[model samples]
Target: MALTTALNAASVYGAMSRLANRAQSVQTQAGGSGESGGLDFGNMLRDQVKSVVAQGNASEAKQAGLMAGKADLVDVVTAVSETEVALDTMVSVRDRVISAYEEIMRMPI
Candidate 1:
């Protein structure tokens, strides 16, 4: 049981990293020219939020299809698992960012 749980966690983290790498690649390509560009934090955060929402919607759709006898149980499970991983990654990042902000606020400068 422990081994199974470990593998499951590893798989989720691997999926999360792949998604993060893909997003990073797109951002790099967009900012490559460096002539008409700079990173827009607002847009970046908005895009990430949109992606998470879309993943959630897709997972819900998969669940609905399964209930309607139009989808495979495995597929629905995979969709839901992927959405869960994405959400976990986002929460971890948020926590780290908040911690950093708090640390800066406490600095003597």
Candidate 2:
């Protein structure tokens, strides 16, 4: 039937669209700039860690303001907590990368 054929075509199109979206997501996660090649993983990680540390510092300043009755305690706490989690994750990633580098260096050329 024509209805069945149309439905199949629609289903195929939908699947293709989903696949394209997934590919784009993967590319973005891999640090590819739109139309540009992939970014260096170490550089990307370093930049992210630096940004997270800056956020953490800002959160600390906000917390200090809360203590001085300038900002809300709840907002300050949430910011600080999120920053703490980011910093912890950054530190863990750095440790893993360093360990991998050391292991690689230990291998005979």
Candidate 3:
């Protein structure tokens, strides 16, 4: 189980690295200035959400493969673990964002 978790974490790290690389390439192509050319939080959030959805689909695919005897138990387990972790992380981020927004709304003028 610990090994599975570690492997899943590594996969998440790889995904993050890929996203960062894409963001950098996009920034360069757009010729964004240092101030206005920084990564957009909305785009990053959308990309991460898409990544999480893709992971979920992958987990489902692995399960189907296991059922068809085309995938190993370990592979299915790892995919599911990765999906679960990604979903949990996304949910946590969403909750924190909401909390922060609420706090800001409650602040004085």
Q: Top TM-score: which candidate number? A: 3
Ranking by lDDT: 3, 1, 2
Going through the candidates in the order shown, the clash numbers are 0, 0, 0
- Candidate number with greatest lDDT: 3
List residue ranges in candidate 1 displaced over 4 A: 1-37
TM-score of each: 0.65, 0.58, 0.67
Model 2 residue pairs with clashes: none
lDDT of 3: 0.76
Models, CA RMSD each: 10.7, 20.3, 9.0
Q: Please, what is the whole-model Cα lDDT of each candidate in the order they appear?
A: 0.72, 0.65, 0.76
Superior candidate under lDDT, 1 versus 2: 1
Candidate 3 structure quality by residue, lDDT tens digits, 1-109 = 8568546755765665566567667867877534556877856775787788677767777877988999999999998888888878987997999999999999999
| TM-score, prediction 2 | 0.58
CA shift of 87, model 3, Å: 0.3
lDDT of 2 at 93: 77
Task: Report the C-alpha lDDT of model 1 over 36-92, residue by residue, as the tens digit.
Answer: 477766457547756776787677778779889999999988987898888788889
Among all windows of ten consecutive residues in candidate 1, which has the lowest summed lDDT? 5-14
Model 2 ranges with Cα > 4 A deviation = 1-36
Clash count, candidate 1: 0
